[model samples]
Target chain A: MALTRDDVEKVSLLARLQLTDDELNSMTEHLSQIIQYVHQLDEINTDDVAPLAHTLDITNVLADDVVADCLSREAALQNAPQRDEECFRVPAVL
Target chain B: MSSPETQPMGGTPYAVVVGLEVHVQLKTNTKLFCRCPTTFGQPPNTQTCPVCLGLPGSLPVMNRHAFELSMKTALALNCTIPYFTKWDRKNYFYPDLPKGYQTSQFDLPMSEHGHLNIFSENDEFADKQIRILRAHLEEDAGKSMHDEAAGVADSRIDLNRTGTPLLEIVSEPDMRSAAEAKAYLQELRLILLYLGVSDCNMQEGSLRCDANVNLHIDTPAGTIATPIVEIKNMNSFRAVQRGIEFEVGRQYTLWQKDKQVLGDMPKQTRGWDEGAQVTRAQREKEESSDYRYFPCPDLVPVVVTDEEIQAMQQQIGTLPASLRKQLLDDHQLTAHTSAVIVNQGLGFADYFLALATAIDDSRLAGNWMQGEVLRILNEQEQTIQQFKLSAAELGELLKFIQSGDLDNSKAKDVFAVMIESGQSAADVMAELGIEKVDSSQLEELCQRLVDNNPKIVADVQSGNPKAVGALIGQARKENSNVDPGQVRQICLALIEKL
Candidate 1:
């Protein structure tokens, strides 16, 4: 259950979080504590009990296959930080 | 666990284990989670909605048709459908992925534990059954177009394909060679097309495949296993086959160079350089992204009922394999012809079968479909939908030929006319003024020919029956519309009387 500072740094990079050194140190400790707390459930002998996936007991909650009104082009790209006449442009990706 | 047998390549013994991950776009009216129309090739971002664009506070609702289609496909593939399944968030950062994560099935998929049979070209693994590990449902990412064509440096994102429903099918590493992999893909595509689950068109990106390949080589002390390399960028089945072939050799050579590379190496990602016809390493193990997966908080878990599974199982019609077998065994069709008929696609197969059933001659129906019908259809650039002749019309033409009313050549002419005018055979025949000559007129022509061409008649009576061909030609010269076959019969009778 223990998490190292390196683990925190790796996860931060993966999440694209630009954490300062102070925050990274704190995050390492906080994540370790959270993991230790969550690891308590592993101690329980619930071999027979099925793992729960969802909080609700319902299944097959679905929407009908129907088309609805979609946002117009102007409205859709309204929140886009960078856009052109037809598309959202990003920096060069390789 | 079944391991594929070792195969020898380039005078060295090696075992190639290939697994596949195929993504097939589901045929639905709208996107999987949103109300945007799931149409391909539309203007970029036109089909984007708040939900699909991953805007704040936008939630995903499961599409009923997408689930139904996936269920139908799973059933056709003979996968085990559990009573419950749910979606998970596969977290990754890519420009094309607007949501920063894809809602996909992780631990529990829609279906699993299935197998597909392939007809491999290699004699060692012909008619092999490739085990399917699982098939899950997921939403597709938007396309990122690096504007190299436009001479622009910036890349553009087309969210039109975003949120489109896709079925990702994962196969066990049961394929030993590239040919087996290709055959497996072909069979799987046929099944999906038969189920009407997806369009299965690779050109349109409706269907895509990536292969995970590794090599096992026998060494002095023990078997040495190479690191698994997952290859992408294969656009077609042929590309997949060639990519696997090239990767197999590359991995074996790399393994031979350094035996220590096996245990230390992590699963590397490669891209098929289609022009170079070789797989180029894209990313090493350390550079690989770890997708933090978790349950999607928005969409609810799907519960498929037993009754629903039963209904879907029933909905799947006779699969292509069984139908091909039936055509071969019961209908007495050659394997090549049966494969052609089966692969002509759903509509054409139905039309061909219907014509075969109506005429009670599967062989002749197959011959006509393979020969004249296909030739004309190809020449005219038409599909069965665009084909003017119905099954009944074709069946009637076959009946006419079978019953001696029309010869094969005359029937071909009639078929051409029908295709051109989109008219029925009877109508086309009438328009072309094609008819069987009456018996009385044929008899009179025979008598005239016998009396005038005494030498030819004597030659025929003296056992040179080939002389009758000249008489039929003369008779045809007199009345161009007369049936030459009928004229030959009449000449035989006249010579007998003489």
Candidate 2:
């Protein structure tokens, strides 16, 4: 299926991406090609096979519920774009 | 019952359909995928780690206890537990979401196809079944507190709540009215609390709910279905009921204006204007997102063996509903009284049970607990665990009342002193000089009072029965430990002879 301009625009908005009008047209064509190439597997359907969710065959990779040292308040806010003394600051959010 | 003018939709009588999504934070020691402490009201960002902060190359490892707790909840809810389950990433953009994606259980939830029995508190529906669509496990995002202190323009994010284990339970649209919805939420919270999996305190944000509501209007043409609107920002169960009630009426009125609003209208998202007491539209429902869900490369699917499931089932113990019924049937307590005892946390309920066992009078024990114990808890701001009086001591006090050694009013005074001094009933009674006067002593005291107060005796002789009240007060003052009713009887008998 060919990806339309509207489809690309909608996804871009969901991804919080800003694109110009010229970039929107080219991105739609490129995404359509990528999706088409991936959809080729649909042509050769092995009905007997099972769908794979993980590449590894292992399951239940778990850790015991134990606490260890964590990052301090200062270290956690070191790389924040904006921060107060003890919290990360950002534009007003609702 | 509503009057014709107060009826919904100008007396159109539309049917309301409601579904609920309840989010409860699991009471685990650490975060779901990290070692950060899941402590509430901590200093901001102090509980952060590389994995929870979504730093580069950080991997996630599932907390085994969180998964076990989730399985226990599923089993308690009568849900079908899947043998195999995996996590998926739900993508979204929010200031509080550091990873921009939440690790959640998608298509395959932890449990599904369950039903919660809601006994309407006062609604006409005797007992309703609210179907459960799914219950999934996820991690909570941090909170963004708007309008920082000192009139700061920016918002502040607290990461202490980030990465906490959360279980999202979704219910089918089986609720017909706001009362039924509130009952369903109350029952669900009670079950979770009894299971000891969550605190379920809405004020502290440990438990939250969002409701999806719509209306169905029956007309001459046909039945019209209104677009579903999801409501958020209800902080309490009462707010939830009121919010759904307001939304149901609002939708009916909106649909009456234009029939075209039903078809092809996108589902809307609204916020409960708590102060305004109305549901305000925030935005039109956007197209569903392509979350691009896939199993996390770092974590593997969870495989639960039958043995583990059986163990979890055993851990659930006796449910609160069964205990409430037992208290009603075996102990002959009222349903309302049983609920009050059961909702006082497990410790209080167990204490009452011990007292009931020690004394054969469960009703009286329950009354004392509900009246005196809870009053003290409220006044002193103490919990059942912090209550000083032991269950045995309380039982002994009740025995004193039963054997006519103490009256009900005197017992309350002793209870207060016992709680203050942490002393036994016998000790407090002795310290306060409280004891029952013998019948002979009471009779003698009444004879003395009647002989001394001739004016009151003449009034009593004239057959004014209430005139004897003063003689009873005089008897109490003379002994300070006489039952007033006994005093009245003895005083009237003495006056009859006079």
Candidate 3:
């Protein structure tokens, strides 16, 4: 189902969102309508049908076992909302 | 069900059921639905586009390369290529998934019913092949990186990897051991390389694995076990191994307590703590997540003809399995030795073959490679491509092994110079004064050994031929070039005369 204001608020809470009530209500309506449209596919018989995972048949893709350049400390930290000398700063996740 | 302490010993004939889901990024010049350059390690957020960032009006246009790589990966996995495949939006909300919905293959995935050939490196273990259920294409989420510098205050999102195209390959629950899992991942990585797909860097989160593990315990009614807990986002081989080990044991322990869950509850997602060797809980009650999957109205279904599949198959070249088998037979290596040779990327394997072609003794080239070359590269934590030694210099070194001038032992010293000075192997041998001693000189030295170890010589005189091995060892210490096998033959004859 598309996210409704209630659905949005529920998911936001599940996802630890601190949204305003207006944002929650708007998101719930938006989500419900989207879900309604997505549910239309349920009419088709898919029980016997295998779920599709890829669009192409190609397989065996590999990376060369070589090390290349990585972001410098400055580059990695450039866009951090907050940062220190070596890494990004974050609120206590614990 | 298995008992905790007694489980390891008296466990009944229980089957090991395993399923694997592999995520691989496609090699594209840009993000899957955006033109934000798909280069790794770019400045964070600098690579983000409005579409990748999920700006209100920005819509996703599929990257052709992403689809091509997905199809290529499916074909290589020996999957049944779908005649018609389409994309769906798996609606979910996570800060990492900026779009709040992942554009993935759901009901009409790209490929299905494929298998990868997985033969163990160890001859002691039985060889087995497992089937890959399917491999699908999807978009990757950005990273929710905690600040390294501001460790106490705030969290940030760097969308460098956002919208990166990924192939989600799910395998039938068939793997049995950590070694088998590692081998599977290794083979999979090479296939990507051969196809020239994604860079597949685990360090950069391009190639990441979440191992699903559970143990079945035998009971009179039937074998039963707890639901499989999935271990996720492991970045290294060792981590994969450790993660699997922990989950397998955890499942077995739950079974031992008669807590084997037959269906939904036991299966949950877990994350690995590499330092502690324990798999911590990430999410629970997650047998199959219901995103209420539906086809994305934005994208069209991708259809391919048989001709296109055949053409791609023909264009595809040698893979790791066949190449490994060829090398073992043609090069006369132990199966164990050849397995290690293949584990190193196909490029490294080809480099060895190229060097071997120029040398007189190909086996020696393999030996030197399996030994000194790997050692040096490992010591420095460098990849083969990063090795300062050129292939030509390695070729020269192999030549020295071929000639009578430098025996295998002396060749080690010769290798040092060649690696550093970039000199010819022969020249290094000469400069180091490691030329083989004359046969006549060796024979003369052998006589002295016959005289010195008289007791051993007496034993050989009495027709105990094994005693001559001791003399051969003494002679070899004095001269590295002296062939112990040849000296063993000679010392026996001389002792008979005595």
Candidate 4:
């Protein structure tokens, strides 16, 4: 029902977001308001009903295992911010 | 056996607790949620599609074959399949993960509560059951190649492996030592191979494993458990064993100084530096809550009927454990010998079965399989399927030895020639000019040798049985095709009559 600054910090860290102190405080309040707004659904007496896993009523939407044509290397790397000859380049992970 | 490395400084014994998380790439024609071919070693990022690349407005649909293969593997491991399972989005921050999340199963995994029995090669440990906690199907991430040598400090991403179907099998911390852990991995790999679900090729990254290792020490005060460290980057099973062993020792030494228990610190993630043979600390492991898993709204839940589960069970066929037992029971082979045959994989096992059935001699067939056949396979770097000699041909060749028509030495020569020339047993024998000496001809040859050697015959008749060895050698010199055992038997009888 409520969020803490520590929780916001942890979430930000996991999301790889760098936030300043003011941004962290504002985010803590904003996220808490969003959680409180969503918690309004708890007021409904839906305990008897099972939790819905998906919005749709259908199940087992599957496709057969068949290979289709993929994009060319140039097309795949076209949108990358930076790329090498055959791969998308990013900041070193290690 | 408790080694000194596993023992604490206070003369207290400790047990190494290792739980393995094996990730096997499902052998499917396409990616899990897309039609892009899941081929390895292709040009980087060439296999990308709208769905696998996580482009906006692209809906992801599950691959039917990938789920079925996962079910087949779960059944083979004796796991309980749930009737209903749903996918969840595991949010993470990694460059290789194009979607910024991995689609995996959360609380409701596909299968759970299974066990695999692992057998040790030696008396190091007894057969034990490694319990499976859960096995869930997930989409694999792409590969990140770091160019440290060029000092670029940039990493290249290969999205070819993105969206590939991977089954993550999590085993309980049931292993007590490094050896047991290795055995568990080996047995699991063999089963996966037998089911034809995954290639289980460690070199190709089709099969990968990360081990959670810790130590439970028996101190005078009470039992103290070290903080569990998850070791990754072990490319092979041997590396896994050595990594766990090294971790066990390192934890013991660390505990001796700090006396820290499991909760004193957060769980650590370490990488196995195989070159240095040490597990270096990488980072602290995040709790499951850090992943912020939530049900994915894009994909519908999968529901399996009882009939479908039964069909999958039937499709699994005979697993390695049952096949090993069958090898022991039907073939009357030793446990070690049966394990060897089964571990060579299903093709080699089938080859042995056909050959043994044809010859009606299990031990002889097992011996040949372990001795000559395996040797040739290793030397030629070929699988049993690639072998030149068919089981029927090998059986026919062994039948000569069984019927006393060919001696073991000559039979080996024929076997070699048959392999080289791709000829059948009869053809090879004929080509080598090796004719089975008829029983009467063999007897006549033995009689000539016995009569020619009067002193040898007198010694044999006077109770020196070994003196017949000289006459058998003479019979071999006379006719190289003569069976020495038959010659000895006929010569001894003739000398007794004289």
Mark the regions of model 1 whose C-alpha exceeds 4 Å error after superposition.
A40-49, B1-10, B120-125, B149-152, B260-262, B285-289, B437-498
* Highest lDDT model number: 4
Clashing pairs in 2: none
Write one digit per residue (lDDT tens) for candidate 4, span B412-445: 8998888888889888888878888898888888
In model 1 chain B, where is the ten-residue run with the lowest total lDDT? B1-10
Q: Share of real interface contacts recovered by each model?
A: 0.78, 0.93, 0.12, 0.96
Please name the candidate that would achieve the greatest DockQ relative to the true structure. 4
Per-prediction DockQ comes to 0.74, 0.81, 0.13, 0.90
TM-score leader = 4
lDDT of 3 by residue, B150-225 (tens): 4344566666788888899998877866667877887788888867787778887778998887766667877666
> Residue B312 CA error for candidate 1 (Å)?
1.1
The C-alpha lDDT values of all candidates are: 0.86, 0.86, 0.73, 0.91
Candidate 1: tens digits of C-alpha lDDT, residues B316-392: 99789998888899899988888988887777888888999999999999999989988977987998878888999
Residue B332 displacement (Å), model 2 = 0.7
| Candidate 4 TM-score, true structure as reference | 0.95
Worst 10 residues of 3 chain B by lDDT: B1-10
TM-score (0 to 1) for chain A, all models? 0.81, 0.88, 0.80, 0.90
Q: Every model's Cα RMSD, please?
A: 3.6, 3.2, 6.6, 2.4
**How does each model score on TM-score?**
0.89, 0.91, 0.77, 0.95
Interface RMSD against the true structure, candidate 4: 0.8
